[model samples]
Target: MPLPNTSIAHALDLADARHWTRQPPKRPATRLRHLLRQTTPSALALRLFAYPHTLTRWAEGDLDGLTPAQATLIEREIYRTWQPEVRRRAHQQILDHGGCVTAQLHARFAYTTRSGEFHDPRLLNVIEDLPALHARHLFDARHRDAADDELRRILADGIGEAYFFCALPPDQQQAALTISDLHLIHFHY
Candidate 1:
């Protein structure tokens, strides 16, 4: 009930209350005072002033006036912390489209995870490994070197559209859904 003494915890509580309860205190320090007023002063003091240690930094003016870069850094940190969630969303996207199909591979290749953490289907133990699912493509060891060569060429050429697709083997290219399929509209002609 009492807001945690930590800044991260306090921010999270504020964000949750703002988003879910639609009740955010008008002033930044109001929650601190409200918590202290409701809870035992000694308990509040112990938690707020003693254990976390950052309170002293705030009191000493060390944590004031955060720069935009600092705020961005914190946001990025929080985003990075949600890698599991990102992976879950990506994995779901893959599964919902028909597992391991050529269309699914194309969709996945074009996908971008917001958190920027790499999700190896194999690492997540998804139903199929990238290579296995694309077996018709790169699983053939004979073509691995050629595939790697193609991938390097595509990357070196600096083509944005081909970045992900270029990484695949010939078989994968053959199996992939065309860009037209990916952007198809259901409008009546």
Candidate 2:
């Protein structure tokens, strides 16, 4: 029995995705930040296919004067030590009652884990979000950092995910398969 004529490493790198990510065109900007408030997360993911810069302000968490919708989108998209909604409610309660929920975040991540079974689909919160978390724990922070570096590359500009998925090691790619529900990874190959 012979394997098929395709490479698992070459599986999902769609051409447009590759082009958009690897060589983002230099384009003049005008009111691009406004685009975020008007776009849904899913639509924004596809829009990154042609215009990755349109997401800059939102991705950078520069929502200073942006509308509530834009800020909410950022809150929903990024992981902090805790969910912003829960934090906000706790803060509000403290303003009124002078006491609030407490938390200590030595680290926060965008991780997922699963059962030992190869086909498991449940996402277990563990460790990830390299840049945001400084690769704290659950990452080979020492040396020969192959897996962590690979994950960082996939998350580099946000647009590289689909194009980079197949390039991950088998176990990592398998883990990614369960994360499409979060819209962070997709199997377009």
Top TM-score model: 1
- Which lDDT value does model 1 have at 118? 39
User: Which runs of model 1 end up more than 4 angstroms from their true locations?
Assistant: 1-62, 83-86, 89-96, 99-189
Residue 149 error, candidate 2, Å: 17
lDDT of 2 at 186: 20
Give the lowest summed-lDDT range of ten residues in model 1: 180-189
For each candidate in the order shown, give its overall lDDT on alpha carbons. 0.31, 0.32
Give me candidate 1's TM-score against the actual structure. 0.24
Per-model TM-score versus the true fold: 0.24, 0.17
Candidate 1: what lDDT? 0.31
- Looking at model 1, the pairs that clash are none
**Model 2 accuracy (lDDT, Cα):** 0.32
Give the worst 10-residue stretch by lDDT in candidate 2: 7-16
State how far residue 91 of model 2 sits from its true place (Å): 28
lDDT of 2 by residue, 32-138 (tens): 33344555545654624433454564345543445545433343222221133443443344334533211111111233335443333554322222222222221
List, in order, the clash count of every candidate structure: 0, 1
